[model samples]
Target chain A: MELFTPDSGLVIWMFISFAILFIILAVFAWPAIMKGIAERANFIDKGVEYAQEAKSQLDGAREEARGIIDEARRQQADILRDADKMKTRIVEEARVAAQTEASKVMDQAKESISQAQKEAEKNLRNEVSAFALEIAQKVVRNQLKDEKSQKELVETLMGDMK
Target chain B: MHQRLFRYMVVIMACMILPVFALRGEDLAGNSAAAHEEDKPIDVKEIIFEHLGDGYGWEVPFNHHKRIPLPVVVKGSDGKWHVFSSGKITDHQDYTEDGVTFRLAKEGEHKNKIVEVDALGNETRVTDMSVTKNVCAIFLTMVVIMGLCFWLKSWYKRNGYKVPRRGLGAFEALIEFVYNGVIKSTLKDKAEKFAPYLLTVFMFIFVLNIMGLMVVFPGGANVTGNIAVTLVLAIFTFCFTNFFGTKHYWKEIFWPDVPLWLKFPIPIMQLIEIFGMFTKPAALTVRLFANMMGGHMIVIVLTLLIFIFASFGPIVIGATSVVSVVFSVFMLLVDVLVSFIQAYVFTMLSTIFIALAQESGHEEKHEKKEDAGGGAKEAAAVTTL
Candidate 1:
């Protein structure tokens, strides 16, 4: 029978103790715990979002870097092509200048050689005239010295002239 | 695998049988020597009830006569409050102070309880507000609950939302299990509003249940098994359910949507609904009380089988003790599980009751649509109840 009875003192104690526990927990304990859980959840969520953003930015940067490398390669190819064209043009111009220089040297040398040949020919003519004149004078003097012989030689020359 | 399995079975059988034979030899000599003292037959019912009931003090292990005294606070017949150690009045001797005499009642309705006696030898109950064994156990439970609560609160304070590790982690898991698995799931958005009471009751009953299993010192008091304690807890649910009940909830109870014939002719639905309101808490009280009380009774009964079989000779006594010990051990393990279950069930039913009381017209319509979409479990629970 006592087992079935609800004692007044115990019921009162149960109510009082339970009420105190509830008040203490609701006011002091549960809020802080729930807040902490929410905050940690928020922190982790933000961390994941930031990581995703960083990854996207890194991907974009990598793409831009690849583009820049390609552009630099294209520019390098253009510069090399321009350098090749310039080298060919310079070589062609040098060859033309060299040919023109060689022709000019040949023409000047030919003109100088013609002038030296004319001078040498003129000197030889003069020398040969002078030598002939000297020989004629010697021959006249010898003939006078031998008048007799000279007279007979002059008759022979006249007959020969007729 | 078969051989190993056979070996284990044989070993277990040997273990069970070995204890019987070993205890047989000792009990044979003991029983013969104590045969003349068999006039006092074992009162299995009394022993079981004593174990299931509360006391003025805690029973000492291996000794029934000795106990650890607790304070007994009672109002005397002289209209004065008296406080003394329960040990003073336990010896069937009267303790008198200020011309008022009190003794622990030995028989009748107030048997084994502190009472006052006049000169004519008429025993009357004074306002007994003693911190009896159950009350002491309640205090111990409170201390444990507070320690756990503050421990959890401190973790949240220091670490700010980090799940605790080790023992505290296990405590957190239980908290979350009750909160999420029962309270939040049933009450949904309203869980937080009633969460304090719900969580407190859950922890309180749970701690009391576990302490009841210890059978010594801080445990052994069947606080939850006492109907008085369960009645208080159930009353709390009743208050929460009704006080916080919605207008629609009250409407559904008194002026239900049954046909006019049912409402006017016999008021059948109204009568049933009103009866249901009281029965809900009653069921809660009896469910928890009976479960805990029964678990304790079964264990005590099993252990009593040894003494009950004493007249059958030493072999029977020894064999019964072995079987009784094994069964009681198994029952205790089961009771541990029952403790969790009963606690869980109490909290869950309370949550559902509160949730039902919180119901409005809008949710009913929403639930109807939900039922079409395969969400009829909550509805079914309500209907079944």
Candidate 2:
């Protein structure tokens, strides 16, 4: 028996079959495959959009929080300044009122001491005048007595002479 | 202009060299003009099978055996018909007006022979023809299958049916399976570009593999069981691998920057790795070829046993036929799985090669590693200081 040999026709047929197979696949199968891929791409794009939106929202919230904190700090400082001003005004007013009250008290004390001194000087002078009058009265009485004595002595001399 | 010129010169050289080699080869084979005369009447047989004569030849699968035949039909000057088989041309002597002349060369009587003829009407006989029925059947089956596929495709297209149904539908499903499962997965970025070629490879191998398993059925050809087809496929892959390879891929293969100590060994290892790249596809070819061939061989061997034990009578033939049928069916199921697997394997490997060729490197990962290394080095230097 002779050995078997493949015909060139078979090889040609193989090539033809291969070509036909490729055409059929390109037409029918490719679309579905691409569709699935496109879907996956769309999913990724959506995910990225969501992430971006979230980041923007987070930044907006942070800015809002910062603004609130700054406003609160300003309000607190304003309150402290007003309280300090009110405290200083009250102290000044009190100091002025106290000074006026003290000066009034001092003037009243001086007036009372001057009135007492004047009254004491008048009383002392009157007392001294009464005493002087009393002494003068006593002296006049003595002197009159002495003058009588002298008159007596003079009278005795006169008697002796008579 | 220089490249074109060079290419043209190469083509011219090839064209010139090919014919010279062919003529030299023919002369060395001791082919003679007189021997050509003896092969005249056999020319009629040439018309029966197109592409099966003259210097043209193809390898065929035949019951676990592959054969190459170069059937020549030569007409003698004396107006006689002679059939010169591949190796045997002198078996049938030239019946001349003078007497019968015998050409003696090589071994074998009427079986497996070759014929040689010299000048001055001398002839040499060499028997070396091993044409079997199985081989003819295989050849015929291949032709018929190809014709059927063409007719069906054309018919379907002409009818203007929007969607494929029946035969076309099944074929379309197979295409989708390969495209989605193998090509898309392996060649993620460029699967679309490579889909058509990869799909073609998948379907071609798949159909041939399925046919290989159809031996139990009448009129089946085991084409995939032949190694030549697989070798051709492998060569295509090898060419594609190198042709489509990117600079980065080649850099990794050739000038890999391994550590200084490992650099010498690495190149040697890379040489092996480069060799391995070719061997991978070669192994793919050989594996598919061997598996298909082995399965067919087993089936043929089983069937042959029935004939060998003919002395056991009709009962034995019946029992053996039943067993053979059962085993062939089992093998057929396994072959179906293998058909898809082999197709997938080929596509997968090809896609990986393409992916490797097109890879640009993971820049993000590389940058991250560099930053880490720099940070560590800075810390170490600070500590030293």
- Top-TM-score candidate index: 1
RMSD in Å for candidate 1, one decimal?
7.5
Cα lDDT tens digits, model 1, B1-385, are 9999999988977876785676556666665644556536987877888898888888989887888999988899889999999889877789998889999998998888888999999999889888888888888888898888888888877886566899988888888888888877777788889888888899899999999999789899899999989998999999999999989889988888888988887888999999989998998898889899999999998888877887786678767877887899999999999999889888878887888788777646577335323323543353333
**lDDT for each residue of candidate 1 in A1-162, tens digit (9 for 90 to 100):** 878988777887777777777788788776655566557768889989999999999999999999999999999999999999999999999998998998889888988898888887878777777777767767777666877978988999999999
* Number of the top lDDT candidate: 1
Please give the lDDT score at residue B95 for candidate 2: 30
Query: What TM-score does structure 1 among the candidates reach?
Result: 0.75
Q: For candidate 1, what is the DockQ-based docking class?
A: acceptable
Best by DockQ: 1
Chain A alone, model 2, TM-score? 0.53
